[model samples]
Structure formats: structure tokens, C-alpha cells
Target: MMTERSIREAKAGDKAFILWDSQIKGLGAKIFPGGEKSFVLSYRVNGAKRLSTIARVSELSLKAARERAGQELVRIRSGETDPLERRREAREAPTVNDLWDRFLTEYAPERITLGRMTTGTLKDYRNQAHRYLLPVLGRMKVRDVRRTDIERMARIMAHVPVQRNRTLAFASRLFTVAEHWSLRANYTNPCRGVVRAREEPRDRILSDSELAALGKTLTSLADRYPVPVNVIRFASVTGFRIMEAAGIQWSNINFERGCVTLPQTKVGRQVRALPPAALELLKSMPRINDCDFVFTTTGKVSVAYKHLDEVFKMVCQKARIENVRMHDLRRTVATTAAGQGVGLTVLRDLLGHKTVQMAVRYARQADSAVAAAVEQTGGNIASAMGVKPKAKIVHIRKRRHG
Candidate 1:
């Protein structure tokens, strides 16, 4: 009599037709009907034998079948299991969206410690992530995301360069946080290695003709909106952001000293001296007893963001300028001063940049005045020689040349 154990082992490599049927041990392997290369294993699970595929002895070697059987035996002993069930559980786990929410709550507040972000900027980050990234990749496991996924996302976003670049940057930052926080085993920034779309430069400055048109538009806006006009004028002169100009208070200004002190900026607290034009504008506006803000919408300390949006857009349209943002007006201030021969270090301090490098961008826009100053004095020695400038040259030669 063939032993059951021997019969099971024989099923591994034997091509001969064999079959077994029993209740407890259940039905053993059998040649699949109408096929020689396929076999069925009728095995017991939870007191009932279920049939599962075990490839033909001719196709899958005896060693392979035994090895697979051993692995399946481990699963069969684990109470209840199915390949599809295992896969489904993996699919339902928390994903990139869950982590992004946690990260924004935990990381941003601490890292962005200088102060709160502007309401507009916060909304922008939220909308970009939600609208672009989360819908596609949010359900995928953060660990499962590979460089290829990032590259593909970037390629798809090639049409909208700036926003696309930002979305990729946000994804990169998210992975960085995951690595830093130990949520991931490896620190893989999917966005790190991939090439991104070239970010088009935005260094918009109003030309003289554009400024003339803008001035005309401002005249009309000033007639309709006094507080917004004051804010706009303040922005043009002082290089303060719209919110910063709106938030300015009487206590922050020292008119006698000709200075405006910002307790908080996008970067941090910064101090800027009031220019004569800004001073005159401030002087011309009637001081309101109801509110302390130098510029207010409705006797309140804050200016409505919407208050200036349309007016600024109207000015841009009237001027027929393209891609000119509000912050570009601030650039105009730095550009103006740089053209007036202001030193980079002085402009850095005037603009209240934390570092000199931030001010260096405007350093390039420095006009003829800087070059003129350089040409007016050939060298330091020219100033030293009051009557006649001297030309001096020194030369060096290597030993081989000599």
C-alpha cells in the first residue's frame, strides 16, 4: 500500500497520473483535466479541504513544489489566510495624506518660528498640495514612492512650470520630513535626483512708461479708495509688503526721527527709515482717532486683502504690463536705490535682509551710476594723486616662461 506521506512526496516530481480522495486528509494532487502541465492540490484548511493550484511536475521541479508547499504550510497553520486578503489589508493603511497633515501640524509651526505665515501663502501651499499632489500620490504608501513616480509627476507638470516646480519641491520636502522623523527607513527624497522644469525668472520692474500709466491709474484709485492708495504708496516708497504696510501703527512710526519700525515681517522684525515721499504721504493723511493703524480699511487695525487686489490688477491692466506681481513694486524700490549708486551692504541693511546674498540680486541691476563712479576714479591711487592720475602695472612670469 502506498503511504500517504510517500504519495505527497511523489506528487512533487512524478509525472504519472495519480489521485486521492478522503475527508480528513482530503483529496490529494491530481492531473488537471485536459492538461498535463497543471496539477491541483486539494488541501484542508479549518476542517475543510480547499483546492489550490500547484503547477505541473514537468514545469515546476520537485524542489520548487516542496519549497512552495512548505511556505504554504506556514500560512495554513496561521488560523485563516488568503493572498487577496493580505493584499487588501496592505491597501487600506494610512498613506501620504495622513503623514502630510501630521507634518504640517508638527513641523511647520516650529520651523517657521519667526512668525506666522501670511494667510495667502498658507492657503497657497495648501491648495497646491491638495489640488496637485494628494489626489494622485496621497493614497500610495510614502515608503512605496520611488524616484520614478516623482519624475513622472514632474514630467506631467512640465506645462505649468512654476507651480509644477513648487509641487515637486513640496513632495521632496515631505519625503525629507518623513526621513528626518524616522517614518521611513531610508532617506529617499524622490524629488532630489530628478531634474525639474526650468523656473522662468520673475524680476518684474515697472518701466518709466509703465510707471506713468500706473501713476495715472493710481490717481483714479486714490480718488475711489483712500486707505488702499495710502497702502500702495507706502509699498512703492518703503518696499514693505501689502500686509506689513497695512499693519503699520502710529506707535511703530517715529515721524520726528523719520523711521518706521516693523515689529514683525515675513522674515522677522525689521527696521526701515522713512523716506521723504513716504513721510509726506503719512503727513498728508488725517490721523484717525478710532484706529491706531497707519492704514486701515474700516477703522480696524488690519487691511482687507481684497481691498487692494482689484485696484492693483486694474493698474497692471491699464499699464499693459505682464506677469507683474505686487512684490515686484518692492523690487522697484531696491532697483531704484541700486541705480543711485547705493552699496550692496547698504542696500542689504536698508532692505532689512538677514544676509547680504539676498540683497546681491539687486546688486546686478545697479545702473550707470555705479559704473560711472568706478570710471571717475581709475584707482585709489588716482584720488591719492590730487593733480595727476598715475597708471601702474605689475607683471609676473612663471619659471618656464622666464
Candidate 2:
């Protein structure tokens, strides 16, 4: 039997021992030789005995300790696993930080090597993880993360909607992979129902006058920065991504076939047709000795993407063109081709798009082609009506109005 007076008068002996409570089967007060006291529960599970410290005796009254021990015993009898063991497992569980390391080193690289992801996309994932995801969720146990945690992260990054959406996507992928890795349970992804931020698709393209201005600027810069200038020119004519243009090796080019084959790209392997103008431009390039790249800052490596972008910015400034990006050059090529009566299917192949829908955006920008078709149709109609197609307009001064 245990009472508050007995618990208080209990003295530490030469050895530590526990005084069992008469009312609670497994509840006891453990007295240590150092005079320290704690409430403990002694129980058995599957024939093996176990003792778990509930709390310090000084931390709880007799009534409170009995209530806690009784609840734990009831939970055990009702088929719950050992609470102490569950806590131990939780303490050793993998965290978001561990998942992040595996994702970056194992998952991302494997996908990249298999051509399922691009290096650029991997870079973006790294940025999103370090800048947003890790800061909030790194120390949390993978299995314990909830939808509220993910939504809170999204709210924290609400200012940059696009980046916030990207981070959310990254986190979603992380949780999904964690499930596969057994770091978390199945179907327990926290980002499942989270809403992504809205994003407006960019449709900016360089007009004919803008292209001419850009061309003039490139001509002026060609003497000093020939590699970047030619790289930009290649992008404009062939609609290659800037990195694709920069990474072109001489071995990838087939002048006889008039094409360049890229072994790997954002979408995978692609072969782009090289027009006569593009082929001529390639011939005029000065090849460095022992260099395989078509454009190079040094003989060993190709011109970097950063260098190309910086030069493009300078050229745009010199040309006085605003709101034009390097990627818009690729769009300009697609639009120009569309204006020349190129069909959607052909445009898809020209732009190396997997589907015609991706090329349809450029079709809407073919205003010149539309105008030309309308003019030709009207001229044929007039000719069929016995009216001269080229009637000159003679404007006479309007009679003075009284």
C-alpha cells in the first residue's frame, strides 16, 4: 500500500528498491540510495518483463502518478505496442535532413544519369531545398511531418510565388521518394493536398525590328566577342537553347546532312536541322586546335552559360531592346518559321517539342503570315470580279466645307 505520508517517509537504503502501490497493479515508487525518487511502471508483454519510468516522484502527486500508470497499463492491455519502445524508435528515426542528403546524392544523380532529369533541373532542386525546404523541415522526423508543416513553408515563401511553387514541388517529390525508401509509411506524403501558386506563362518574343536591332548589335560585338556572338546567332537561326548552342561539339555537326545531333537535352536526345545560313556561319567559325566544341573560351572547355548570358545582356542594352531574354531568341525563330507558312507539325519538329501543343503558342504570334494570307485571298477575289488587283488610290483634296 502507498500513501502520500508513506511516500514522503520512505528512506533510501543501501540498495535501490521500489515500493509497489496496492491499488495499481504495476505502479510503484522507486527509492534510490542517493535519496532520489521516481514513479515507475513494471509490466510484462509476451512473457518478457519491462520497467518504464513514468516521471519523477517530485514531479507528480500520488493520485496523478497512479492515474498515468493506470492509463498506460490499460493501453498495453488493449493491444497497443510498448510505448517506451515506440519512443525509442522515434528517437532513432530518419529525419528530413537525412532524406534530403539521399535525395540529392542518390535519387537526383540517378535520374540525371538516366536522362530523366536535366542538370539545370537538378540545380533548381538544390536551390529550392537549401533556400526553402531545409530551413523549415530539416530537423523534423520524416514520418512526423504533416500537411500543416508543408503549408506553413509555402506561406513563408508566398512572396515569390513561382519559387514557392517550385519549393512545394520539391518537397512533394522528397516525401514521395521517402515513402519508397521506407523512411516514411506509404501514401503519407504531406504535400498531397497543398495548393500550388498561380503562375503566368511568359509569351515574350522579339519582333522583326527588335531582331534587326539585335543583329546590328551582334555585328558590332562580333569582332571582340566572336564566340558569344556566334553562339547567340546560332540560337536565333536554329532555335537551339543557349546551353545547347554553347555545348555544340564539332563531332555533333554533320555538314553533309545539314544537322546537329544533341545526345542529351532537357527532354532527351534530339537532332536539329542546320539551315544554309547556320551551316555557313559554322564554317566561318575559327576552330581552336584540339578543341571539339564549336564555341569555346579555351581549348579545353566550351563557353560557359553564365558568360553567354552576360554577353547577351550587354548586347540587349546596346541594341536598346527591353524585356528580351536569351530564350526569347528561340521563340523568335519559331515565330519567324511559323510566319513563313510552317505547319504546326513541322514547327513541333523544328522546335524539338514532344507535342504540337507546345508549338501552338508560336503559331498565334504569326501575325505577318496571317496578314499576307488575307491580302492574297482578297487580291484573288478582286481579280475574279474583273477588277484590277493593283488599283492605285488617287486622293483629291477634300472640298472646303462651308
Candidate 3:
């Protein structure tokens, strides 16, 4: 047996040596010339000998060290595991930071090239990882991370429910990729079972009056910021996403076909039918020399996303529109189309959505339109039936005596 007194009183020699425990086979206390001490376990498996450090003397008492060594010895004898090899593998495991780097350099770009992921989504993932995931979990081994770790991150970001939910989604995606890459075990994703914060979907849409005001503001500012103003108009008329509108080239337009063909979008390739108003808007845009884009500030590239957003914000402020985003313009287009009796399938195509479910919300607006039409029909029928209207009773107050 290895006693605490023996371990404490053991003298350092000129060379490091282990004092084997008499009671527990293969368990020993290693004493180094530098006066350091640790408990080590030596064992053989399949005719091969290996040594694993159980713990430092300062970390475990003699009884604790004996129990650990006995457990490891039993596992080795049963041919179930090798303690040395397991420790070695753990030491070589990839950390979350490594997984993140691989995700960015391998998984994300590959998915982007395959059209399964969009650049905008990639930008958001990068932003969320840097702002939340990497700071806390980066140092942890990929396989060692638990659900509690992810839940802690979510709790830390609970104040911003939208951001917290997005971060959790991003972390979930990273771990899924890690499993695909064999860096983590399948079905062991730490993000699993972690509760995500509830997020409210944005449903803001610009009304007709607000749209008119916005158009007026754009016209007033067009002379000062032609490209951004035109870009906004294009997005509004086509119901295109902000990035989709900003990335459009002149070559994408077909005046004869009256459509624009996008080789890549959030949902992949799409051909959107352009109304005459949209075509006329495109026709009026002055093309810069040697510029391939429909909207450009330097003639070398399309208008930057940030600049377009800032210009839109300024235009909205001048138009006196409240609580409206540029994306609301896209919603407005969908709502207008739905109210005009456009079916769900056509709305899906118009919005370049992959599924008809994405266009289903606009069905409610169409239903409201139907209800108004029915109310009008009912009024006409009532008049035809000669239904008498209720007489109004006016209340009068008599003068008070002085």
C-alpha cells in the first residue's frame, strides 16, 4: 500500500524513480529530482506496456489514487479501454476555436459555393460567433463541451432575445459541422437540449401613404444620391432583398423578357418577372461607362450595403415614416400582390422563396380584401331589398333659469 507518510517523506534522488505501491499492483508514487511528486499507473494491454499519470500527489490522497488506479487497471484487464491511449487522445482533441476556424475555412465556403448558404448568412454567422460563442467556449475541447456551457451563453445574452436566439442557432450549426468533420461525436452536439430564447418575427409593412411619401423623398434626394435611391426603388418594385438588389448587374436584366435573372440568391437561382413600372425604372437609370452593375457609386462595384441602408434611413426620416425598415418595402410588395389576388405559388416565385409556406402570411391580407368585397356586395343587396335605415335620435339640452 502507498501511504501518505511514505509519499510525503520520500527523498528526491539524482534521477527520477517511482516507488511502487506494495498493496496495489502497477500503482506507484513518482519522485523527481526537482522534489515534484505524482501518482502514476503502469499496466500492460495486448502485450504492450503503457504508463498514465493518475494525478499529482498534491491533487489526490493515497486512498483516492489507489481507487483510480484500480478502476483503470480493471478497465485495462477487461479489454474495454486503455487509460494511456484515452489520455493521449484527450490531449490531442480539437478545441472549439479550431472547430470555428475549420467551419469558416471549410464548411461555410463550401456551402456557399454549393448555393446552400448565402454570403449574408455567412457574415451573420461570423458576427455572432465573434460576439458571443468564441469568447467563452473557444478554449474548451470540442468533445468536452456540454449543454450547460451553451445554456450559460444563452442566459448571458437573454436580455437580447433575438440576438441570443440567433447565436444559439449559429452555435448549433458549428457543432453540426464539427460532427460532420469527425471532430466531435455524432449525436453529442452540445447545443442540443439548450433552450433558445423566443424570437418575434418582423412583419412590418409600409402602407400606401407611407410608400408614396417614401417615393417622394427618394425623388427629392435622387439628385444627391442617385445610385442608392434607384437601388431602393428597384428593391421596392421587385420585392428583392437588400443584398439581392445591391448585387444586381445590368446584364441580369432582360427588357424583352421583362424579367431579371439572378444566378444566386438566398434560396438559390431565381428569375423574377418585372412589371412595366420596374422596367421603366431600370430604363431611366443612367449606366456609367465600363460599369457592369445597375447601381454603382464608383463604377467598379455596386453600391455598398451599409451606404444603401444609411441612405434609406435618411430617406425614411425625411419622409416622416415611423418604425419602418428597408425590408418592410419587400413586405409591402408581397402584401400588395396578395391583395391583388395573386396566388400563393405566384407570390413564392415573385419573392424568390423556396417554399410556398414563406408566402402564406400574405394570404391573411388577401382574406381581408375578400372580406371588404363581401361587405360591399352585402350593402348593395340590402339596398336592393329596400331595407330601411334606423332613424337618428338627437339629444337637446334646455336653457337653465338664472
User: If both were scored by lDDT, which would come out higher, candidate 1 or candidate 2?
Assistant: 2
Q: Kindly provide the TM-score of model 2 when superposed on the true structure, using C-alpha atoms.
A: 0.80
lDDT against the true structure, per candidate, is: 0.71, 0.89, 0.88
Per-model TM against the reference: 0.66, 0.80, 0.87
Q: Judged by lDDT relative to the true structure, which candidate is superior, 2 or 3?
A: 2
Q: How close is candidate 1 to the true structure, as a TM-score?
A: 0.66
Please give the clash total of every predicted structure, in order: 0, 0, 1
Which regions in candidate 3 have their CA more than 4 angstroms from the true location?
44-49, 77-84, 366-402
lDDT of 3 by residue, 176-272 (tens): 8888888888989888888776666666778779889999999999999998999899889989998888888888889999998888887888888
Which candidate number would show the highest TM-score if scored against the true structure?
Answer: 3
List, residue by residue over 103-181, the lDDT tens digit for candidate 1: 6798766655646554445556788788888877887887778888877777777889888878887788778888887
Off by over 4 Å in 2: 2-19, 29-39, 44-49, 55-81, 367-402
